[model samples]
Target: MTESSALPGLPRRLLADPEMISACASRDFARIFQLAKRRGGFHSSRIARTCELTPSRVGEVISGKRKITNMTVIERIADGLRIPGHLLGLASRDWERAEIPTQPQPNAAMRRLAELQNAHTTVPSRELDDILAIAAGSKVTPTVLRSLQVSIEDYWRRDDEHGGEALRPAVIGQLRYVTGILQDTADPNYRRSLHGIAAELARLTGWTYFDARQYSTARTYFTESLRLAREIDDRTFIADVLACLSLQATYQDRAKDAVTLARAAQDSARLDGGTPRLMAMLSIREAFGHASAHNREATHSAINEAVHHFEHVNPEDHDPTWVQYFDRTKLTVDTGTALGQLGDAAAAEPLIAEALQAEPTTNIRARAFHTFWLARTQLQCSKVELACATATEALDLATIVESPRVLTHLREFRQLLGSHRTIPAAVELVARISETAN
Candidate 1:
C-alpha cells in the first residue's frame, strides 16, 4: 500500500494545517485521528497501516478509549503523516520541501504548506531576530542583573515545590533569553554580573534536567555553567556546580566519578572561603559518594566532618542563596541516605524518618524522595509490610509531583518489591505503578 492509496480521500491540506500540527505535537492523538476520519475522509484501518498500529488500537485511540504515551509511536505517526518534525518537538525533517506548492486557486493544500513552512522555518528566525534586537537595545544595569538573579532564584524555588517537569521548559526559555542578554552586553562589570546570573541559571537548568532524567542535557548545562563560573572566578558557584555534577554522577551509579567530583567541590569550597554551611553541604555529598563506592571508613569520616562543619556554621555568616536549602534536616537526610546506600539500613532508618517528619510541605519532591528511601531502608531491614505501606505513600506523593527523580526512586522501590509480589500490598503497589506508567 502506497501512502496515497492508504490515505484515500484524505486531503493533504488538512494534514499539514498548523493547528493540526500543534495538536499532534501536544499529543492530542485522539483529536487528530478524529479529524482525519471525519474531515479528511480517512479510515482507522488506513491510519493503523500507515502508523504501524493495529486497526483496533487505532479505533480505540480515536474513540478516546486509549492514550498514546509512547514517544517513539508518536514520532512514527508524525512521520507517516508527513507532519513537520519541529511541530512535534523534533528536528526539521530533511524531506520537508523548501518551497510551498503553488496552486492557481489558493486551495487548502497551498495554505497548509505555507503554514508548515512558517511554523518550521520563518517563525524561528523571526523570533531569534526579535530577541537579538531587544537584547541589543537594552542597557545592562545592576538593577537588571539583580532582577534576573531574583527571577532565577524564584524559579528555583518553584521547581523545588512543583518538580522539575513542571518548570523545565520555562527555565530553558529564560536561560536562552539570559544568554542573549549576555551576548549583547558590552560593559565589563555588567557582563560579569550577567555571567554570574547566567551561570546560576545554567546550573538550575542542569539540575532540573537531571531531576527529569535527561542526563546528557543535564551534563551539557552543568559543564557550561562550570566553565562560566570559572571564567568569573566565582569559587562558590564553581563548587556548587561541581556538587551538582557529583549528585548526577551519584544518581547514575558512577561511584568513582561521584567521589572525585564531590571531593573537588569540597576542596574548591575550602579554597574559595566558602561558608561553613556550604563546606558542610559539600562534605555530605562526599559522604554520599564514598557510601556509593562502598568505602565505609571514608564515608564515616566525611559524614563526621560534615557534621562538625555544620555545627560550626555561624548564623551571622553570609551564605549563598543556593545553599539556603541545606540545613540540619537536609544534613541528617543525606547522612542517613548515605548510610542506607552503604547497607547500614538499621542506623539509617530513624534518621531518615526524623528528617522526613521535619521536611517542609513545600518541598514535595524531596518529601517523596525521602519517603522512597525510607521505604527502601525498611525493606532492607526485612520490614516487608511497613516497607510496602511506606512505598505506597511514596508512590501517592510521586503522583502529586512531576519529578522524574522521585519516579526513579519509586522505580527502584518497585524492583525491590518484585521479590515480595506474593504480598497483597506489594501486588497492589506493583499494579499501581504499572497503571501510572501507562
Candidate 2:
C-alpha cells in the first residue's frame, strides 16, 4: 500500500505489505489477525483487546476455526485498529485525530487532506464484480435522480440541525454510492443529471468536512465538485463552489484569496445571469472576506451590495435549490458575523441577537454559531458578565451539535475569558469549556 493509502497510526512496515490493506478492506480478519501477529509483531492479547474479542477467539479466528460476522464488532475492530474507514467500505474516519510522528509536523493537516483528494479505492475483484452486476441490473430514472436530490437536501437539513460529525459518514457513503452510479449509467441525459447531483453531493460533503474543521479535505471535495460542475456547464454550481472555497479561505486567514475567490464567484454568477439571491450570497461572502482583512470601507461596500441584491430578490426568480435557505434571517446572521469580526460589536450585538432569536429551532448549528458571534460582540464591548452568560448558552447548544467550527469558536471565547479569569463567571465558563473538551 502507498503511504497515502495507509491508515493513521499503523506501522510503516505493515503498510508496506500490500496484502495488509487488501486483507483489511475485504474484512479478512483471520488473515489480518495472523499477519498482524506475525509480520506486524502485535501480541495476540493486544489484538484481542483492540478487537474486543477474547484471546481464544482471536486465536481461533487466526487459526481459521472461527468467523467474525457482527457489523458492530467489525466497526469496533476497524476503529480500534485505526483502519481507514473507506478501506472497510465505511465512511472516512476522523483523520484529524490520526496519530502521526511525534516531531513538529508542519502542515500535517494539509498532508492528510491531500490523501483524500481522489475518491478512487482499490476494491477486491469480487467486490468490483458485485458492484458492476448491481449497476448493470439497476435502471437510471428521473424519479431516482429526484429522490437522490431530495435525500441530499434532507441530509443538508440534518447537518444544520445536528452537526457535521453526526452526518459526515452517512453523507460520504451516499456520495460514494452516487458516484458509483454515475460511473455505471450509460444514457447521456441520465449521466448529465447524475453528474449534477454528484456535484451537489460533493459540495455537501465538502461543507460538512469544513464544519468539522477539516479544511484540506473540504478543499479537495470543493475542487472536485467544481470540476464536475464545469463538465455540465453548471454556472450556478460553479459560483456556489467558488463561494464555498472563499468561505474556507476566509476561515484559514487567507483574506486576499478569500476576497478574490468571492469576487470571482460574483463575476461568474453575473456572467451566467444567475439569480439575484445567488449573487447576494456571494457578495455576503466577499463582505466577510473584507471584514477579516479589516478593510472597513470595502467591507461595508460589499455588505451594502449584498443587501441591495437581497432586497431585490424576485419571489419568482429562478433560484437554485441550494440557495432556497438563503433568507432574511440568514442574511442578518451573516452580516452580523462579518460586523463582529470587524470589531463593530456595538452595531453587531443586536443584529446577531435578533437573528438568533428569529432563527428556527431546527437550525441548531446556525443558532450555536450566531450565539457565539453574539458573545464575541459582547466580549468586544467589555460586557464580560453578559458575554459569559451568552457564551455558556452557546456552549450548551454546541454540546448537542457536532460542529468542530463551533467548538473552535467556543475555544476562542474561552481564551478571551482567560484574561478575565479573576471574575467568577469567567472562571466558571473556563471550567465548563475544559470539561466539555475532555
Q: Give all TM-scores, in the order shown.
A: 0.71, 0.71
What does candidate 1's lDDT look like per residue over 96-159, in tens digits? Answer: 5542445433788767767777678553445432444374465777776776777677677657
Model 2 agreement with the true structure over 58-127: per-residue lDDT tens digits = 8898876676768788776776566667656677666525555445436978555445544464433544
Q: What does candidate 2 score on TM? A: 0.71
Q: lDDT for every model?
A: 0.80, 0.81
Return the number of clashes found in candidate 1: 0
Indicate the TM-score of model 1. Answer: 0.71
Query: Residue 121 of model 1: what lDDT?
Result: 55
RMSD of each: 10.7, 14.1
| Candidate 2 segments whose C-alpha is farther than 4 A from its true place | 1-138
